[model samples]
Target: MPEAHIARTGPRILVFSTNPISDPGIDLVGSAHMRYQPGVVTIPVPCSSGIRPSWLLHAIEAGFDGVFIAADGGDCAFVPDCTTRTAKIVDTAQKLLTEHGHDPQRIKMAAICSVCAEPFVNHMEKFSAALEALEV
Candidate 1:
């Protein structure tokens, strides 16, 4: 019997993560020996809420299939409403994507804690699948 081989066909993704929380969680993905797409790249930021919407759009225009924002949520040391502010940023980016004739769903935001390696991997897999479906 021969085993079937599966190839990864998803587009590359850009992740903007909060250094205090989501960054550690992303690191845990490696420490746990989890496997995500090799094309997944992460950029650590002081806070997800501080990311300008234009940056997200730029990522897409730069040929990334998707962008994910790992927000600090309520665990942000810098702000009380991290989730809300981050969500607003995502909303603005989504609109920008739409204005540029792209699908807004190409961008996503989620609350990822420092210990959330599994969740982060799950999100990556799901986002990759979604992007493949989009074929953009």
Candidate 2:
């Protein structure tokens, strides 16, 4: 089988978003005509708390420059402790990144609400900048 190809012109970021919450906010960025880095890609999951640390590491190994977790925070309807659980996932992923000689800063997490189009764009911009700086 041929290897999958992703042509990236700049820092490539993979974002994990909660389907019920942050996914809508990320979608709003496009609907509202807000622009972010072309390399930013998002995959919606049922809940942020369900994300596996191994998946985050796999993204880095698969050529992503960074990974961002758009956590549901206090607004999660699926898990009452979603924020805390997601934070632990970040911590574990960072530790694994460090163990494998990768920069732990490549992972970031933040709360993005359903109506946070502008904020989502802002986060993407900031994350892109941060990833670029890491390469320097």
Candidate 3:
């Protein structure tokens, strides 16, 4: 997949990752170079499941188009019947945003592994698409 490009005037995105995200996640280095543009930032988090609602809200209020959360869920997978906390938190946050008239799609989460580059990139693409669909 090609790197996702955001026009200079477009709303930016803050990607909060719950696991390691490598450079190869993007299709090319040239595209990767554009990452620091006004519209994109990648932040590493301990776990996507544990991200707080307050943090998400802060980003939204700061003019970010959206927040994309990706987590290495192998831990959760190994612990069956343990509905992970991060998943629940993200869902709760989405609901809260909707109640306030904001498009809940602004907050998104995906279960992914660092080594599985394609799925991770796909999630980012989907998140970007959703943000694009928002009417601001």
Candidate 4:
């Protein structure tokens, strides 16, 4: 792929997060001086459920090694079934990735509340490691 041929200093990650829930959690990570891969990039969305499966595919093709969706879960004020809807989105994206000859595990989804800074950091660490292992 064109993106693959581009040189990168480290694995790139794209994080899609909900504004009310996951965004705060991500901010907390910085406020608390938490350590995670600096290459992890975040984009705040109104809700994770609204993300199109093609967007995830585009990210991978654009050179992102992994994609992470930080869902609002039970804290979602927009939808009662936010988590379920988000999961379905991930599942669809995973299927598409597999059909395109990519590993589905590169995409992941998790409920991240306002206080989930630690969890977010941990997830980033694990995901970065997973991508590194894929290079082996």
Of candidates 3 and 1, the better by TM-score: 1
TM-score of each: 0.92, 0.93, 0.69, 0.91
Candidate 2 lDDT (Cα, 0 to 1): 0.93
**Model 1 residue 52 CA deviation in Å:** 0.4
Q: Write the per-residue lDDT of candidate 4 for residues 1-136, one digit (tens) a residue.
A: 6666855566799999988889999999999998787789999999988999999999998889999999999999999999999999999999999999889988999999998999999998888898888867
- Residue 132 Cα positional deviation in candidate 2, in Å, after optimal superposition: 0.6
Model 1: weakest 10-residue lDDT segment is: 1-10
Q: Per-residue lDDT for 1-136 in model 3, tens only?
A: 5576644755477876654433234323235443323466777765555578777777887788887666545544334432366677778878777776678889876665544455655566666767777854
lDDT of 1 by residue, 20-130 (tens): 999999999999998788889999999988999999999999999999999998899999998999999999999999999999999989999999999999999999899
lDDT of 4 at 98: 95
Scanning candidate 4 in windows of ten residues, the lowest lDDT window is 1-10
Query: Which candidate comes out best when scored by TM-score?
Result: 2
TM-score of 3: 0.69
Candidate 1: the clashing residue pairs are none
